[model samples]
Target chain A: MLGPILETLIGGLLTGVLYSLVALGFVLIFKASGVFNFAQGVMVLFAALSVARLSEFFPMPIAIALAVVVMIALAYAIEFLVLRRLVNQEGIILFMATLGVTYFLEGFGQTVWGSDIYKIDLGMPKNPIFVLESVFPGGLLIDPSELIAALICAIMVVALAIFFQVTRVGRALRAVADDHQAAQSVGIPLNQIWLMVWAVAGIVALVAGMMWGAKLGVQFSLSLVALKALPVLILGGFTSIPGAIVGGLIIGAGEKLAEVVLGPVLIRMFDLAGGGIENWFAYVLALMFLLVRPQGLFGEKIIERV
Target chain B: MLYREAGQFKTSYSADQAIFSIAQDRWFVMIVLLLGFVGVPLVANQYLYTEVFIPVLILSIAAIGLNILTGYCGQVSLGTGGFMAVGAYAAYNLALRIPDMNFILVFALSGVVAMLVGVLFGLPSLRIKGFYLAVATLAAQFFLEWAFARVKWFTNYAPSGSVAVGKIELFGFAIDTPDRKYLFVLALVVVMALAAKNMVRGRLGRSWMAMRDMDIAAEIIGIRPLNAKLSAFAVSSFYIGVAGALWGFLRLGSWEPLAFDINRSFQVLFMIIIGGLGSILGSFLGAAFIILVPIFLNQLPHLLGIPLSTAAVSHIEFMVFGAMIVFFLIVEPNGFARLWAIAKEKLRLWPFPY
Candidate 1:
């Protein structure tokens, strides 16, 4: 019993880390542009699909490097062609434009890759580090892949924190986030800042995409992971990085725990075939969080002007 | 000269307050309604009624529901599809379980059920507003979709997770034919559209507009936020629910949960945005524009004597549709309703150098 619980916890933590990575991309864009990019999940799908196709011919490492370069170029193109044109639009218009981007990317990705699921060979070293013995007689076992993913996520978070706090460009990015007009008054080129932020967001999306694809195999369904991040954003607040990370863990673990504890009872009560609450648990939890604190765990309270 | 209203005069306040005070406008509307009710049934073919008119009418009704909430109430929603699903499933159950129940009664009762659900989901609006509320409504979308998909009760434990309705009848007259179905939907559309127009022109509508423009100012003027918000939800859901019932029973005749997916929500929302938020006329225009444009695009190649694959047509359809949305937003951010108003203003001063 203890072993299974521990294993579930580990699995939940790894999945939560990936969600946090996606959430980071969302926050980066929202903070800088004040527009929620509904297409962020599609960006992940595009990156994963691009990498999978590229790796069909090139060696693994070379394919990955090429994919990175392509993603960066794609980032620049999106900024130059789309976001730049949408500058000074209302937040809702910008949001809808990203929705258009979502549709365009989905169709374009499917047309290019042909709607078939592709296996992603990231070539990461996959081995169990150790087996854990439960305090109970029958012990649970944990996988090293889950631990590795979590560790990688932690390192990435630290690096991002350090970059934002220490680097000059990061300072400029923060300035732009703080107040776009004030940052402009300080001679920061707003368009350049937007391009930089989008690039950074695209890179984070690539990392998230690769990690998630390595787990689930590259497919359109991977975009549903964005649904998980929606609740995470609501729980952690839209603008808080730390909130996103913590919120992801809470939601991921909460879903798993609900499945373990209440899945059977509810299944019997509802006379359902599937006895797991994993699908609806996260949404229900997030709805409760919204009711309790709409600002979320770490979001700033909004002040409406008359 | 026949279209001109030069001799029309309002002698009383009630006459001036009539829905169509101008003689020309009144006569034009009567003619259109007459053509819809009496003319279309006689001349329209089955394919036109089933494939084009029925679907467009149902969608226009749904668009009107969304326009009430998102346009007049100023609350952006992404759960229109979910609420529609609730109405549909509820109507399905009501029509099926109650052996002697009339189909029209089922439709009306299903709308009431949808209203309850709408108010339940709308409770979040008391605390959240704007984009936050939009995100909150997504929970409703996913939850309802999951419920319909996973819960066998919704499908009445059918072998497949799909529901179907038998032929509908009213007053011992079978409504199985396309002409009869078209007339049925047309009648509902006229009744509901008039009801919506009247509702929006009333005091309740003013409160909603006030809240939409500025909630704080509305509160300062003594309008309770809770009342204004929840009533908007109820009324909006009521219309959407009826539309859903009609969509299921009259139009599709059979459907899976996929009929009311998130994409449906976005489509209805886009209709409201493009059609003009607060106007009933805008809903019809928006729905017609969205529904007809795709059909026209699909048929264009055939009309032009070019053979194109359906896949290619669909792809081009998507691209052109997306581009058109951006173009319309750029050109007239207020939507087609605003354009209609502008035209009306011009008509009020025609043939003169003001």
Candidate 2:
């Protein structure tokens, strides 16, 4: 009993790392642009697809490098086309524009990289590892790829934290996030900062894509990883990176545990096949949080002005 | 000169307050109605009725529902599909449970059930605003999608989780033929569209607009945010629900939970955005544009003698819509309705060098 429960906990926490990475992209863009970039999910799929396809001819490192260059170009192009043109537009309009971007990317990604599923051949060892065998009769089983992903996420988070703390652009980013017009007054170019943030977000998406693709084959469903991140963003607050990490962990654990514990109970009570209760556990939890605390765990209190 | 509205004056307040105060505008609407009700059905084939008009009309009602909440009330919701699902499943259950129920009555009750669900989900709007509220609506979307998919009772225990509607009849007239279904859907759409028009022009509508413009100011002026927001949600859900029922009954006749997914919600939202958020006619314009554009896109390569796969055409469609949306926002955020209105304004002052 203890072994299975511990394994599930570890499994959930590891899955949460991938979610944190995705949510990090969301927070970065939302902080800089005030636009909830709905296309972030599709961008993940696009990045994964590009890398996977490019790997067919080029080596893995070369494929990843080329994908990075592509992502940077995409970031710049988005800044030039949609973001630059729609300055001072309503947030809702910007959000709608991202939906358009999502559609474009969906088709564009499928068109460029074949629509059929592609295996992201990371070539990671897939054999199960035994831990605490002596302590428990049956040891906890762990997937090597998931453990690697969690480690990469930890290192990335640390690197990002350091970059933000000790860099010039990072200070500029903080200034802009605090107040856009004031940052402009202080000689921080808003457009450049936006471009920088988007580029950083693109990198974040690429990292998230690689890991998720390795776990679930590079396909359209990979885009839906964004759906998992949304509840995280709502719970963690869109501006706080640490909030995202914590939110992801909670949501991941909650959903996984609910699937194990509550799913069967509800299934039996309803006298039906197993309810895919995992699909909505995080969202329902987030909804309850919204009702009680609209600002989220770390979001600043919103002051309405007329 | 063709579109001129000069010398047409309103004689009274009621005349001034009429939907189309301009003689030209009124005449245009009347002619369009005649064309829709009479001209189209006379010449249109089964493909046009079954494939084009029926789905377009049903979806327009759904779009108008979304416009009320998102456009007029300034409350962005991404749960349009979920509310529609509520309507579809409610109608499904109603029709199955009460075999002898009136078709019109079944649709109405479905709308009511959807309205109640909308209000339940809408409780978050009083506390949150903007994107938070948008995300909140998504909870409704996913939960409802899960409910419809997971619960066999919603689909009447169909092993495939797909439900099919029985024959629908109104006053002993079987709604069997494609044209008949088209006419029925059009009539319902027309009534609801008019009703939506009327609702938007009344006190509640004004209150919604006021709240949209500035919620705090609207509240200061004694406009209750809770009342206006919830009503917008309820009414929007009612129309969407009716559309969902119609979609299931008239359009597909059989569909699974996938019919009303997040994609469908986004589609209707895009319709309102591309059409013109605050305009009544914009809903239809948006819906028609969305439904017809892909068909046109599919036919374009064939006409040009270019060999493009269906997937390539769809990709082009996505790129075009993305570019078009950004282009429209940059050119005019008021969308295609305002573009139409602007053309009319230009025509009114044509042959003038300004």
Candidate 3:
């Protein structure tokens, strides 16, 4: 029993890292622009589609590089076309604009790249390796793809932390996030910073898309991962990077454990057809957490002054 | 000018406080309502009733419901679909179990049931705000959707997990025909829309708007956040729930849980946004636009004699819808109702401009 539970926990944690990768894009865009970017999921799907389809013509490396360029162009286009005109609007309106972007990206990705599921092969090993054989009877089986995803997530987090700490552009980004007017008054170009942040977020979407597409095969449903990341944001706090990571891990693990453990009890109690509690478990957990700490675990404390 | 209201006068408080203060406005509304009730049934075909009018009217109720919460109360919700599902399923079960119950009472009871669910989900609004609140509402959406799908009792243990109703009889009149369904839906929608308009005009509506514009300020002004916010949720869900029942019973006639999915929530949200937030009339206009635009897009290629696959047309429709949303948000965030108001304003001026 312990071995099975431990194995599930480890598997959930690895999956949680992937969620963190997606949540990072949302956090980056939200922190910099104060816009809750609803299009992040579609952006992931779009990036993955771009890479997958482009690889059909070009070498893998060239396809990836082209995909990066495409993402950057998309970043610039969103900033110029959508965000630039809607300055000083309400957060909800900006959020709605992102929804518009989401629909556009979904249509555009499907139109440009045929609406069929495409696979990404990073040449990662397909077999699962067993670890701690002596401790458990059958040992714990782990997917190498998930491990690679975790490694990539870790590297990105470290790189982002260092960039924010040591680079001038990163400092400007932080200052812009703190206060838009004050940051602008101090000679930081708001447009440039927004473009940069969006571009970085686009790159993050690319990496997330690749990882997710490799794991599940690139399809329209890949966009639904955005819904999954939303609970992670609720748990982590919309504007905190580290909060996103921790929140993702907690949500991912909690949902999995609940689905495995509590799902059966509910199924038996209610005579449900099957156990699929993970569908809403993460959200309910985040909602409960929010009731206790509305600001989120690592979110900056909200101070409202009339 | 034809649109001018310069000569209209009110001698009493009731007249001054009337929903339509202008005589011309009153006359126009009367004409429109008369046409809707009497003129439409005379000349309309079955296709128009089934394909166009019924859906528009049903969705308008939902749009109004969402407008009351997200537009007036300033609470963002992504769970309109869930509340709607509650109404649909509630109506289904009530009609199934109590075969002798009046259809009207069944619909009302479904609204009441959905109201309770809405209030329960809305409890989180006190703790969270903005996008967080939106996500919390999504929890309600997913949970309710999942429950309706998983809990066999809700569907009456239908093997296919879908529910259907037999012929609906109200007051010994069989409402089996398309025109009858349209009239039934139209009557309910008109009553509900008027009720919503009145509710929003009164002190209750004021309290909701107060909470929406600024919650802290509204609290300072002696409006209880708990009462104001929960009431908005209750009223909004009540309206949406009835719409859902109408959608399930009158429009679709049969539906699975997918009938009121998250996409439905987004569709209603889009209606309010495109119609004009915080305006009752905007809900109708937005609903009409959202429903009509796709149909128009589907026909555009054919009209132009351009041969395009259905898939391509759908993709283009999506692109156009998305573009239109962004365009509307950028150009006129107030939506079509604002444009209509502007048109009215211009008409009042007529051939003269300052």
Q: CA lDDT of B156 in candidate 3?
A: 97
lDDT of 2 by residue, A1-306 (tens): 878878888888889889989999999999877989998999899999999999999999999999999999999999998999999988988998888888888888898888999988888888979889999888888888999998999898998888787899998988899999999998999999999999999999999999999999999999999998999999988888998999899888888888888888988887665678878888889889978988888898878776
DockQ of all candidate complexes: 0.41, 0.71, 0.82
Worst 10 residues of 2 chain A by lDDT: A270-279
Every candidate's fraction of true contacts kept comes to 0.24, 0.71, 0.70
lDDT of 1 by residue, B254-335 (tens): 9988999988998888887789878899999899888888788788889999887776666666666776776676677677
Every candidate's lDDT? 0.83, 0.90, 0.94
lDDT of 3 by residue, A77-97 (tens): 999999999999999889889
Tens digits of per-residue lDDT for model 3 on B188-263? Answer: 9889999999999999999999999889999998999999999999999999999899899999989999999999
CAPRI tier of model 2: medium
> What tens-digit string does per-residue lDDT give for candidate 1 at A1-306?
666777677668778888888888888888887878888898888888888888898887777788778777877877876777777876766777777677677767767775678878766667654454436454555556566667878888898889888999889988998899999999989888888888788878887888888888899888778777888888888888899899889888888877887788877788765654576678778878888998989987888778
Please identify model 2 stretches exceeding 4 Å from their true place.
Answer: B2-6
Which should have the higher DockQ, number 2 or number 3? 3
Best prediction by TM-score: 3
| Superposed Cα deviation of residue A2, candidate 1 (Å) | 3.1
Go through the candidates in order and give the clash count of each: 1, 0, 0
lDDT tens string, model 2, B1-354? Answer: 776666887789999899888887788888999999999988999988887898889999999999999889999999999999999999999999998999899999999999999999999999988888888899999999998988778888899989998888899999999989988988898899999999999999999999899999999999999999999999999999999989988998999989999989999998998899988889999999888977777788899999988778888888777777777777877788999888878887787735
The Cα RMSD across the true interface for model 2 is 1.6
Off by over 4 Å in 3: none
